[model samples]
Target: MLRTTEQKRKYIQATRSQNYQASLKLEGITTTAQTTQQSKAEILQKYKKYSQPES
Candidate 1:
């Protein structure tokens, strides 16, 4: 069975949000351990870039 366009959009949105949230949580833990702003920014930036939809 094939999914509709709206279904695909919803799926992508849900996945992106989940990935973003998970990454944020990971960043929090890592920051607590190391206390480095640069590293945290790098990690979160990488995650967001990787999770972004390909054009």
Candidate 2:
């Protein structure tokens, strides 16, 4: 079956994302909801220093 260029691009992008996710799972680096939240908080905390208003 012939796919349009857009269709082919979408399929390739989806496949690449799926493969990247699968690889992350294989490497035991998948982020759960809790871990995701924690990472977000940690990131915010880490970068908070630069957000201070000038005195």
Candidate 3:
């Protein structure tokens, strides 16, 4: 019973470390991805001088 408990603890720690590493890598990727995706309000502001006709 003690051995199993220890194994479970190690397994959890290993998985948590792996997840943390993956998240660290993804943080960089997400930051760049987010910058590339422009919001509608920002797009409008960029061309604010030219107004779009009503639909």
Top-lDDT candidate index: 2
Q: Residue 44 of model 3: what lDDT?
A: 86
- In candidate 2, stretches whose alpha carbon ends up further than 4 angstroms from where it belongs are 32-55
lDDT of 1: 0.74
Tell me how far the alpha carbon of residue 40 in candidate 3 is from the true structure, in angstroms, after superposition: 48
**TM-score between candidate 1 and the true structure:** 0.48
The 10-residue segment with the lowest total lDDT in model 3: 28-37
Candidate ranking under lDDT, highest first, comes to: 2, 1, 3
Order the candidate numbers by TM-score, best to worst.
2, 1, 3
**Tens-digit lDDT track of model 2 for 1-55:** 5379998898898789778778889999965533233677788887897798879
User: What tens digits encode model 3's per-residue C-alpha lDDT throughout 1-55?
Assistant: 4369889899888789677767978786332323255899988887884785667
Best by TM-score: 2
Give the C-alpha miss distance for residue 36 in model 3, angstroms.
Answer: 35
Residue 13 accuracy (lDDT) in model 3: 87
Error of 1 at 2 (Å): 5.4
lDDT of 3 at 34: 32
